[model samples]
Target: MNGPGCAAGFRHHTRYARSMSGNRKRILIVGGGYVGLVTALRLQKLLRRQLKRGEVEIVVVDPRSFMTYQPFLPEASAGSLEPRHVVVPLRRVLDKCDVRTARVTRIDHARRIATLAPHVGDPYDLRYDELVVGVGAVPRTLPIPGLAEFGIGFKTIEEAIGLRNRVLDKLDEADALPYSDPRFRELRARLLTFVFVGGGFAGVEALAELEDMARDACRLYNEVKREDMRWVLVEAAGKIIPEFGEELSDYTRQRLEERGIEVKLNTRLESCVNGHIVLSDGTEFDADTLVWTAGVKPNPMLRDTDLPLGPKGHVVCLPTLQVKDTPHAWAAGDCAQVPDLAKGPGAYCPPTAQHGVRQAKHLARNIQRVMQGKPPTPFKHKNKGAVAGLGLHKGVANLLGWIHLKGWPAWFVHRTYHLYAVPTLNRKVRTVVDWTLALFFRREIVSLGTLHSPREEFAEVAAESAPQPEAASRTPGQPVPKAGAPKAG
Candidate 1:
C-alpha cells in the first residue's frame, strides 16, 4: 500500500524497502510553538522503540529556546504570575527529541530539505522524510501612522514582562515631575494614559489585568491616584470578548466601564503618531503606552515553502492534518487550515491553543497509522468553551455554548483551566506557588525598565572615559603626530 513511508509519485514497494534499510527516517518539525512542541513530544512517545533503535529521528526548530503558555501572559504582565513559569524550556522538556534553537528560513518539500538560520554560525540545510509545518502566526498589523515605532504586542513572554515594567516606569516618571512644572501636565497626562487596541481575549485580558495591578499599585504612590490614570480600550467591533457570547460580552464591557476604563466600541484607532492616539470617533489623547493585539496572521514563511496554502495564507491541509498534494507532510496550529468537521462543510478550525493541542495529538496518531499502512483518521473535535479573566476575582465564561458563568465562579474556572492546561508538572507547580503567595502578599509593582537597556550606563561610561585626540592634531591645519613622539594628553 502507498503510505507515508513511500513518497508519492515513486514506486511504493521499492521506496518503502529503501527507507527501511537506510538510516532512520527523519521527521523535521518547524516552529516550536504549541503545535510543534506537542507533536514532537507525542511522536517521541509513540515512536519510542524506533527512536531508540535509530529507526526514526525527530528534529524541532524554533527561534526561541522555550515554548510559552500564552494564556498566562496577561497575568504575567500584571505580575500575578511569574513570567519564567509561563514558558517551558524546549531542551529541558524534550530530552528525547533534537531541539535546535534556530529559525527556518525556507523549506523545499520537493527536495526534502529545509534551510535553517541559527542565532550563531552559518545557515545550513537539513533533509527529512517527513515535515510538519507548525510555525505559529505573527501579529497582524496595519499601516497606522507611527504604529510600527510605538505599538507593543502582547504575544510573547518578553513582551509581557516589558509591558509590566513600562507601566510601572510611567508611574515613576509621572511622580518625578513636579505639578508646578510647565511640562508636568502634558507629561503626567501622557504618562498616565494607556490605550489598548483590540477587543479580543488577549487585549481585554491584558487591559483588565494591568488596570487591576496599576490601580492597586497606586496605593504605594503618594502622587499618583487611580483616578489620575486614564485607561481606554478601542475596538472596531461593536462588542468585546464575543467568544463569551452576547450577555457575557456586555457584562465584560459594563464591568470595565464601571472600573472607569473607557470602552469605545465600534471604534478604530486611526493613528498613534508620537504617542498621540486618534480614534475613529474623533476622540484624541496622548498616551505613553499603546498596546496592539488586534489580530494575527499565519506565519509568512508559508509562502517560502513548497506547501500549498489557503487563501488566507495558511498551509492547506486535509482533516487528517496532512498537507494537501503532499504525502508524509503535515501541518497544524495557527499556521494550518484544517477542515473543521464539527463545524460542517467549508469550515476550517479556528486558530487556537485548544484546537492546536488536539490537532497535534491527532496528527501524531495519524502519522503512526500511516506508518503501519493503515488509513489515517480525520481530525474532528467540538469546541468546548472559553474563559476570560477580566481582573482579580472577576471573569466571564461560556460553557458548552449553553451555560454562562460570571464573577468569582468564572474567575475560578479561568484559573483552574489554565493551571491545568500549562504544560509540564514543574510549570504547574511554580504557577500555583505564585498564586498561593499572591493571596497573602501584594503584587510586585517595582519597575525594572532599565533591564531593557542594561548596557546603557556602561556605554555612557565608556564614551566618557575613551581617549580623545589632541585638539591641535584634530585641527584642519595641524600636522599629524609622530609615531615615537610623546602623546599629548
Candidate 2:
C-alpha cells in the first residue's frame, strides 16, 4: 500500500464524487497491473461521455498506481535500461477512470461487491453494476529451507531495480575489502556467485544478461576477474528454454556453458542456509544472491468467491470471456482460464503477456457488446512467435515452428516486439532511447548504495569530523577559544 516509489498518491473518492453526479452505471475493476490498466483504459475510451448521461462510471483498484512492463525487467536489472522507464503511472494515464491504490482482499460475485484494503483507510466494500477480474499472478516460490528470507522475486519495478543495486552492491563490497585477507577474499568470492532457480524465459534471460553485465563489469575492479564469478542456473527439468523446444534448449545450455555459466539440470536447491547454495546432488557453493522466477499460479482470492474455477484454480469461462453460467461478470489475464479454441483440445490460453494484451482488446469489445445488449464474442488467439533477449546482442527465438534464431537477430526481434507492445508512446520512446544509448555508450555498473540509507555516509562523516566541545564554534584553521578565556578575540 506504500505505493511503489511512483508519484506519491491521490484520494480519488472525493474527486470521483464530483464526476459522479450520482448516476453513471459503475464498472469496478480489480488489479491494476498490466491486464487491469489496459482493460480500464479501453473501457474509459469506449464508455466516453456516458457519465454526462449518467450511463457509466469505471473504478479500478490495485495496491500500486503503476503497471510494470515486466518483459524489460531483465534488461533493466542488467543496466541495459533505466528502471524508471519500465514503470508507467496508472493514475496519470487513466485519469478519466476512478483509480484506487487499494488491493481487493475478497470478492462476492453473488452480491456484486468487492471487499478492499485501501492504501491508507480502513476496509470498505465497493458495489458495481459490472466487474472485471484482471488480478494477475505472483511468483511461484517453493518452500525451500531458507528461500523466503533470502530469495528475491522479479515482479515489481522496485524489486528489479533493487536486485540490480543489490547485485552491484555485492560487487562493490567484495572489491572494497583487500584481497590479501583470506576471509575477506572468500566472502568476496561468495558474493560474486549468483544463483538463478528456473529455466523459463525469466530465469534464462535474467541469468544470461546479468551474467553478461557482471562479466563486463569485472574489468573495472582491481582484483575481481570474470573467472572468479560463478553463475549457476538450476533447472529441475531436463532442458532450458521450453519455448524453444528440446533442441534449442540444448543449444541454450551449450551457449551458457560456452560462457562458463554452469547449467545444472535435474537439480533442486537443497538449502541456502547462511547464503550457501547446497544442491540435491551433493554439490555445494556459496552464493549471496538467489533469484526466483520459476512459474506462476492464479490469484488465490478466487477460492473464496462463488465464481466457478477450472482445475488449476482459474475462473472457468467458455469461449466467450464471461464467467461460466454467470451474467455481467468477467475474468481474464492469468486469473481466468479461457479455453483455447485454437488448440482443439481442453487447452486454455496460457498466461503470457502476448495473449493477455490480445485478450484485453477482445474483452473490451465483449464488455461493450454486453452493455449494449448484444452477444459477446469468444476469445481465441494463435501465438505467432516467442522471443527473448539474452544480453546486449545475443539471444535465441522461435518465430513459428522450430525455426530457431540466435545472436543479434534474435535479440533485435525481442527488443523490437517488446518496444512496440509496451504501453504508451512515452514509454516506447524511453525504451528506444535506452536501446539507442546502448549502441554508443557502455552500460554503467555503479551502484548508488545511498538508496538504502541516503544519510548513513553523511552521518558517519559528520561524526568523524565533528569539532570537540571546546572547539564547537571554531572556524576551519582558526584557533579555538578556551572555555573560560577570551582567547584570540
Best by lDDT: 1
Measured with C-alpha atoms, the lDDT of residue 64 in candidate 1 is 94
Clashing pairs in 2: none
lDDT of 1 by residue, 1-489 (tens): 344433332343235335554667888899888998888889989999999998888889999999999999999999999889999999988898888888899999999988887665556667789999999999999999999999999999999999999999999888888866785788799999999999999999999999999999999888889998999999999999888888989999999999999999999999999998999999988999999999999999889988898888999999899999998899999999999999999999998899999999899999888887899999999999999998899999898999889999999999998888888899999999999999999888898888889999999999887756565348677666887997666
lDDT of 2 by residue, 1-489 (tens): 345332232345434444555656788888887778888888878877675565887888888888998999999889999988989999888988878888788888788877877667556667777888888887877888989989988877777778888878887877788877887867888888899999999889888888888888988898677887889999988888787887777888998999999999999888887788898878987889998878889988778788888887888877888888988788888888888998877788988998888887888889998888999988889887789887889988888875788889888888888998999889999989988988899998888757878899899999988867757766679865557877664
The per-residue C-alpha lDDT of model 2 at residue 51 equals 51
lDDT of each: 0.90, 0.83
Question: How close is each model in CA RMSD to the real structure?
Answer: 7.0, 5.5
Where in model 2 is the C-alpha error above 4 Å? Answer: 1-23, 180-185, 455-489
Model 1 residue 347 CA deviation (Å) reads 1.2
Give the Å error, residue 233, model 1: 0.5
How many clashes show up per model? 0, 0
TM of each candidate vs. truth: 0.91, 0.89
Q: Candidate 2: RMSD over Cα atoms?
A: 5.5
